[model samples]
Target: MRKLVYLVATTIDGFVSDAADSDPTGTVFDPVGAHAAPLMAEYPEMIPTHIRPMLGLTDTPPKHFDTVLEGRGSYEIGLAGGVTNAYRHLRHLVFSTTMTGVDDPAIELVNTDPAARIRELKAEDGLDIWLCGGGTLAGVLRDEIDELHLKVYPVVLGKGVPLFGIPTQDSRPGLDHFTLRSATPYDSGVSLMIYDRTR
Candidate 1:
């Protein structure tokens, strides 16, 4: 049984991306770049292969996960930027209904049931599963996630894709408590918080 970790970068106010709800990897914020070395050293496997060349990283050994699960919005950001398969290093699975026949053969699409698909993935033997991006899919598979690695930036985006979407009044089945395992702050004002699911 493998663990599912949602490793994401979010604003201090709990927003993941800029307004209009774009992908997290679309642009590298200047502030984030300051703390990039630490994050890259911590989670090298999460770095896209195409980016490693620029970062001067050789994919020798993965840090944590071997698989990555993403939502349509997260995957489409690459497509919108003319990149169909963003994470060439990991086993990428995208949850989408409207997308099909992407150019990449390594990319897998799950349109039927995201939760069910995640459950099946959890049973497989692997390093771990990285819930790379996707607020909606994250909300849907909230129960299956075993850990959370949040990179909290100092900036605040008042309006954007939320870390966890859905109105507070709406009842979500997987609203579980998490125990903070670690909180490390960087000079660039980016704080890395690791949380393990209480259940």
Candidate 2:
């Protein structure tokens, strides 16, 4: 069975993106500084197909994921930039109810239960599934996440989209636990933390 890895970049205050829902790595800060080389070298698959050539990773095989998952908001960011499918190199899946007529055969849309569908995907033979998120979907599939690979930036957004967009006060499912596996800090004040879900 494959694992579901939530690989995302977040601020020290635990916000994945700002309130405007713009790409944090683009508008808020650039990720091409000192941390770029090691990050891109370690996770080449995370680079978009169009960017691979520029980064000289055009022929590099994906080191981690063979499939990429994202919420409607995350998908729409690329769509808004005239890109219907951003991660065209991988099996792209978008979870959205209102989005219709995607037309891109390479991109799959899941309007139903996220966790259930994820369970099915985990059972199939493949590399790990990358949950390249936008908070809400992370909350929905929180229970199914097997690993968390967080790139913690030094900045602090006073308020924005949180790491987990779930409501905390409600009598929802209990919090899942994870064990920190590794933490690598870069000169750019960015740290990469890897945590494995505690079963």
- Please give the clash total of every predicted structure, in order: 0, 0
After superposition on all C-alphas, the RMSD of every candidate to the true structure, in Å, is 2.2, 1.4
Where is model 1 poorest over a 10-residue stretch in terms of lDDT? 23-32
Error of 1 at 118 (Å): 1.1
* Candidate 1 residue-wise lDDT, 54-153, digit = tens: 8777654677999988888888778887887878888888888888756688988888978788889889888899997867777777888899999888
lDDT (Cα, 0-100) at 23 in candidate 1: 57
C-alpha lDDT (0 to 100) for residue 130 of candidate 2: 98
* Tens-digit lDDT track of model 2 for 1-199: 9999999999888889898888877655568678888999899999988778887888899999999999988988887888888788899999998987575888888999999999999999989999999887898788899999999888889888888884676625666889999999999888899999997
- Full-model lDDT for every candidate: 0.80, 0.88
